[model samples]
Target: MEYIILVITFTLFIIIAKDLAHHKKKNPVLK
Candidate 1:
């Protein structure tokens, strides 16, 4: 159960990071 939770957390982190990156790219003014 612990391992599964860790995996889920990692996946969410990666997804959020990717989304932020995409948003920044879409709006260069963000940087």
Candidate 2:
């Protein structure tokens, strides 16, 4: 379903954002 796909995409986006934030905090070079 479209809604399910949307939820999946949103979840993936949040996960990626969290990972990027964690990486930035871990490595100052990205900041």
Candidate 3:
């Protein structure tokens, strides 16, 4: 159960990071 939770959180982090990166690319002000 603990391992499953860890995997879920890791996947969420990756998705969020990708979104942030996409936003940064769209808006140069973030840089």
Candidate 4:
């Protein structure tokens, strides 16, 4: 159960990171 939770959290982090990267690319001012 703990391993499943960790995997889910890691997946969420990757998704958020990708979104942040895309957002930064769209708005240079964010950098």
Better of 2 and 3 by lDDT: 3
Model 3 CA lDDT for position 5: 96
Q: Tell me the tens digit of each residue's lDDT in model 4 across 1-31.
A: 6999999999999999999999999998987
Tens digits of per-residue lDDT, candidate 3, 1-31, equal 6999999999999999999999999998987
| TM-score (all chains, Cα) for each model | 0.83, 0.89, 0.87, 0.89
Alpha-carbon runs more than 4 Å astray in model 3: none
lDDT of 1 by residue, 1-31 (tens): 6999999999999999999999999999987
Each prediction's whole-model lDDT (CA): 0.96, 0.95, 0.96, 0.96
Q: How displaced is residue 8 in candidate 3, in Å? A: 0.4
Go through the candidates in order and give the C-alpha RMSD of each one to the true structure: 1.0, 1.0, 1.0, 0.8
In model 2, state the lDDT of residue 5: 96
Model 1 alpha-carbon miss at residue 23, Å: 0.2
Where model 1 places Cα greater than 4 Å from the true spot, the runs are: none
Which scores higher on TM-score, 2 or 3? 2
Residue 9 Cα positional deviation in candidate 2, in Å, after optimal superposition: 0.2
Model 4 regions lying over 4 Å from their true place:
none
